[model samples]
Target: TELQSAQRKAAWADVARRIAHEIKNPLTPIQLSAERLKRKYLKQIDTDPETFATCTDTIVRQVEDIRRMVNEFSDFARMPNPVLAREDLRGLVSAALVLQRTAFPTIIFTAELPEDPVIVQCDGGQIGRALTNLLKNAVEAIEARKGNDLPPGRITTHIVRTEQHTTAHITDNGKGLPVENRDRLTEPYMTTRVKGTGLGLAIVKKIMEDHGGALVLEDAAGEGARASLVFAQGNGRAGA
Candidate 1:
């Protein structure tokens, strides 16, 4: 795996370099090609219209996913500076939920917060990325351990305010983490995913620490995991 990973990284680096070199070099009509795929002409044989739709849908969806992966790779190669300012956590989380709803259609994701605004000082873009990664990981974890055709999963976001600190707890009904990996959860280059870069949680941890906060992993109520980001409250912004 290591050797393959190294080779793949080398290949990816070369591709990325070339992408940077050739302005609009990714000129292949991949989307168009997929669109023009052969379709069964026989009306009776193709009576099941659903089959064709599914095939086309899957191809287009996966192609878009690959494009996203490449875009993330590009971003990671040259991460931009954070546009720091006051960010409304509730609104930000809501926006992320909109994005996640598409990827995890069956997973019920909810946000629980006080009516009052819980504003923090940070980069909205970076924080959004952190939230999306955590949500995506939870969804995949749940889907994997869904033993016996279990029903769809759910995630709950609870924002609590204390005298000294604000805590945001994201709880999922996915596979729970081993107690042993708790301490190592945020370690860079550490992960349980086969294709993971092992950097999502690390990036998240950096975000928390960057904002005078800490990202803590804990057990969820019934199942799954809870990643809590604890930060100083009192209406003060993060990184401000």
Candidate 2:
């Protein structure tokens, strides 16, 4: 029994990790192109139209999210060594929005960033996954709060540079995380959602630590939640 359990898990984990790494290489461009078309043409097609274009766009966006999360699962099973590169945080954030914009057409996506590019040493694929997860969570929160009494929500992301660290923060306007859940949010297999592997946040935390960064969860000021990733400042290529 024990041997079966150990071997099965090990095999599954390897498969997952390999899948994540293999698919990861092409996911970005596919997602970005789909996003560009969705943003500029979602309206052009029809009217959230359930028409061909609109339907295709929505499907692409959702598939991208699934792919994004799947990447996390893959990372959990088998992670690659840090392919550290000089990356611009702003570009990563924008690309994340581009991939996800369709999911929250109603929820306002806001950005606060510096005029100059802020660069960090990171694995673009993994770090991008982290940001996407945060944004996805924000959108999910906004969706859950949608109802008779609740108004539409907003998600705000920002990158700030301190003397020694670069911090990327994501905040959302929705029912704030309960006090009890805060401590367990990053723990594997812990989530309020009926369907969640609960590995997204855990993957984010692991990626951060691997790159000399830290992930923080705090109560948002008004009615939602804020998450931040702080990374050690490093010299980087000026552009993304």
Candidate 3:
């Protein structure tokens, strides 16, 4: 089963790499052409200037969106190997939480980090990226639940250390876990959000795997979903 899973992921990665390469080249030219058309024809269109402007604007906007998706595909296909080193997990978590808090002021973000430093072998940048991605997902989930007679949006970050591992849990009061296929959410191109690129969790999972860790997705105790980043204690180079 594990071998099958690995084969599927490899196939997906190859597909992503090819798709990204093919789609990225035309995007810039298309966007530039749309802009040029708008600049040249927007003033001369006397019959329905609004429609012409809107169409050109939509083309430019959609091209940018496609470019973003292609970039995500490239990132997923070419994820860098982790440069693991001893670092303070609490500091990493705090920095990422602060970023999310500043970005989403309305959401109440709480951190329950331990007083003493919890050090782990990881690439700090990759870990921070993972935390930020999860926090952004939480924010999106909370936003989706708005106007549903829900309570104030809240996100909680807590860290726990065991004898063999260190786990950081991000819990949010938003839409709960999906009713089905929860286990496959980390696979490429699988997402519940309509606008999502679906590569965020896949990239995060790859990062965790590179660090000899795992990404765990589950439902929170009461509402919304919780994502945990579990790092194996004293891990060295990946696959070592």
Instruction: TM-score each candidate.
Output: 0.72, 0.71, 0.77
Q: Rank the candidates by lDDT, best first.
A: 3, 2, 1
lDDT of 2 by residue, 61-126 (tens): 777777857755776766555698888889999899887777668888989989997888788988
Summarize candidate 3's per-residue lDDT along 1-240 as a digit string, tens digits: 999998887888888898899989899899999999999989998999999999999999999888887887788786767887778899999999989889899999999999988888889998998998899899999998856567999999999988788899999999887888888899998998888988899999999998879999999998899999999865632453
Local error of candidate 1 at residue 45 (angstroms): 14
Can you tell me which runs of candidate 1 are displaced by over 4 Å?
A: 1-28, 39-65, 149-151, 178-182, 234-240
How does residue 63 of candidate 3 score in lDDT?
Answer: 92
TM-score of 2: 0.71
Which stretches of candidate 2 lie above 4 Å from their native place? 1-12, 15-72, 235-240
In order, the Cα lDDT scores of the candidates are 0.73, 0.80, 0.89
Each prediction's total of clashing residue pairs, residues at least 3 apart in sequence or on different chains, is 1, 0, 0
Regarding TM-score, does 1 or 3 come out ahead?
3
Q: What is the C-alpha RMSD of each candidate to the true structure, in Å?
A: 6.7, 8.6, 4.4
